[model samples]
Target: MELSSLKFYNVIVLGFAFMLMFTGFQTCGMVEQTVLKSYRNDSIVNGTVTYNGDGYTSLAIIYVVFAFANWLAPSVVSVLGNKFSMVAGGITYTLYLSSFIKPITATLYIGSVLIGFGAADKQRIPLYIGLTSVCALGTALLLILRSHPIQKLEVGDPEEDQPSEEEEETSDEAAMLNDSLDVTHRLSWKLFLTRDMMILSITFFYTGLELTFFSGVYSTCVGATERFGEDSDKLVGLTGIMIGVGEILGGALFGIFGKKTIRYGRDPIVLMGGAIHMVTFLLIFLNIPDLAPLNKTPDSAYITPNTYLAVACGFLLGFADACFNTQCYSIIGTSYPDNSAPAFALFKFEQSLAAAIGFAYSSHLVLKWQLLILVIFAVAGVVAFFVVERKVRSRAEPSGSSYRNI
Candidate 1:
C-alpha cells in the first residue's frame, strides 16, 4: 500500500526509523561481538596478546556503565530532545567504533565505556550517527512531503493576558508538585512485583544472555573450530549476517502478523520463539565443536560447522530473540502506560546487568554447557510468559475488559 494509504507518521515514518536505527546499531554490534571480539579473544587465548585482556572485561565495563546510565537517560532525553539525543549518542558510538581500528588496551576500554554511556538512551550514539549520516540525503526527500502532526495540551489554551503575580506563583508551585508526583509515582515495588514485570524481567535477562552467546561465545566457537580454515573470521562475520537477517525478517513478520495472533495471546508467540531457540541450542550442542584447542591428525578429520546448519541456527536464534523482545516491550507499554518510563528503564537496567554477568563468565563456559543453559532458560522463560498471560487475562476478566494484541 502507498504511504498515503497508511498512517504515514505512525506506520511508515516510525517503521523506517526503527529499521534505520536497527541496521546501524545491530550491524555494529554483530561485527563487534562476532568478528572483532573473536579476533581479540583468540589472540589472548593463543598467548599472542598483551593488550585487551580476553575481551570479556571490556564487555563487562560496557554493560555495567549501561546499567547505571539508564537512570540518567530520561533526564538527558528531556534536555536534548529525541533528535539531538540520538545525534549525541551517535557521536559516542562513532568514537567507540573508531577505537577498534587501532585497538590498544586503553582505547578499547575507553571505547567500551563510551558505548555503554551512549546505550543508556533509546538509541546508542554511534549507530545513530551512522544511520543519520546515511539518511542525510533523505532530508531533501522529506522537504517535498506535506504531512505535519501537532500535539496540543488537553487543558484549555492559555489566555492572551499575562497572569497576576499570585497566580504565577501558584502555577509554579503546582508544576513543581506535579513533577514530584510524576517521579515518585512512576516506580513502585508493587508494580515491580506484578506478573508482567516478572515475565518481562526473566525474558529480557535471557535476551541479554543470548546476545552474549552470539557475540562472544558463538563467534569464538566458530573461530576455534576452524570452520572456514584460514577464512574463519570471514565465516564468523557471515554467521552474524545471517542472524541479523533473521532478526529483520522476524521483526517484520511480527509487525505484520502480530495482530492476527493477538487473539491467541503473547504467550504462544513467546513459546514458539522459545521452542525455536531450544531446537537451535540442541543442534548447536550436538553439531558445533567446542572452543577448546583442537588436535587434528592425519587419521582424524576436522569437525567443521555445517554451513547450512550454522546459518539456520543463527537465523532461528535471532528470530526467536525478536519474538521475546518485541512482545516484552509491547506488554510493558500496554499494561502500564502511566508507569512505562520506569518500567522500561528497569527492563534496560536488568538487561545490562545480565549482559555484564554473561560476558564476565562467557570465556569460561564450555559450548555444550552454554547451549544447555540457554535451553533451560528458554524453557523457563516460556513458562513465565504463560503465567503472566494467564494472570493478565484473569485480571481483565474480572474488570469485564478483553485483553488486546500487541
Candidate 2:
C-alpha cells in the first residue's frame, strides 16, 4: 500500500515506533558487547577480576531468564496492551541504562538483570532517556488521537456522534477483557509441533547464534589480531556500525519489496538471506587477506584492505539478517493469525535459548569451527524451511487457495 494511504496509518505509526525504539536499543547493545571485550583487556571496572568476560556472562545469564519470561509476555501485553507494554519495557530499559551511568560492577549486573526482563518482552530501552521519552509521548499522542472527536471524520453525518468518555472506557475495558481471555487459553503442543514451527524454530536458533557471533565474538576476533593491535577495539566498534548500516538497508529493501516476495512464499526470501549469510561465513572461515595483527601504528592499523573486507562482511551479515528475520515474522503472522501470540512467544523462546548457549561458549570456540557450525545450521534451517514450504504449497493447491489452513 502507498505510504500516504489512511488505511495504513496504524502501520505507519507502528513502523516508526519500531524504527525509533530499535535504533537506540541496537546501538547501545553493540556498544555494550564491544566494550565488554575492551574492558576485559583494560580492567576498566573496579572490584571485578575480569570486567570484560563478566559483562558478557551477566548478559548470558539474563538471557536464560528471558527464555522463561517469553511465556509471561503475552500476559503482560494482554494487560498493558502494546503501547503500555512498550512503555513498561522502556521503563525497565531506562533502569538498566541508568546503571551504566555510574560504571560500577554491581550496578552493571543489576542493569543486566533489568534489561533481561525488557528483552523478554522484546523491548530495548533507548540509550538516551530523551529518545524513550519521545516514544512515550508519541504513544500517548496516538492514544489521544484514537479517542479524539476528530477521529470520526464524518464531515456532515449527524447520525454518528463522538463517543462519550464512559463509552470509550467501556470499549477499552471490553478489549482488555477479550485479550485476557485469549491469553488464558495457553499454547498446546499440537499447535506448536507443526512442520512450520519446527523449521522456523531452527532458523531462529541460527539467528540467535549468528547474532551472538557478530555482537560477541566477531569484534574480538578482529581486535585480537596482531595487526589491529591496540586499535582493535575501535575497529570492532566501527564494524558494528557497518552491520547497522546493512541492517537498515536490508530492512528497507524488504519493506519495499516484501509484498512481491510473499507471492512466492516466505522460503525464497529466507533462502536468499541464508545464502548471503553463508557466503559471509565462508569469507570469515577462509580468513581472506589475513586479519592477523601486524604491530602497526594505531592510525595506520585499520587502513588495510582486509579490514574493509571484514566491515563489508558485517554489512552483508546485517543485510541477510534483515531478510531472514522479516520474512519469518511475516510468515508466522500470516500463518497463525489466531494463535500468533503463542507462536511468537515460542519463536522468542527458541531464539533466546540459542543465544544464551552461544554466549556461554563464544569465548572458548575457535573462529573457523564456529563459522563451520553456523554454516551447518544455516543449511539445515534452509532445507527444513524449503520442505515445509513445499508441503504448504501442495496442500494449498488442492484447496484452491494460496495458503493452507494451519
What is the alpha-carbon lDDT of model 1 when measured against the actual structure?
A: 0.64
Q: What total of clashing residue pairs does each candidate reach?
A: 3, 5
lDDT digits (tens) for residues 171-284 of candidate 2: 798578666646533563445677678766787798888877766566556655545444555676677788888888888877666766567677888889999989888776
Q: Estimate each model's TM-score.
A: 0.76, 0.74
RMSD to the hidden true structure, all candidates: 6.9, 6.7
In candidate 1, stretches whose alpha carbon ends up further than 4 angstroms from where it belongs are: 1-25, 33-48, 117-189, 292-304, 404-406
lDDT of 1 by residue, 218-285 (tens): 65555445444565545556777778877888788775676766777788888888888888887776
Cα lDDT, all candidates: 0.64, 0.63
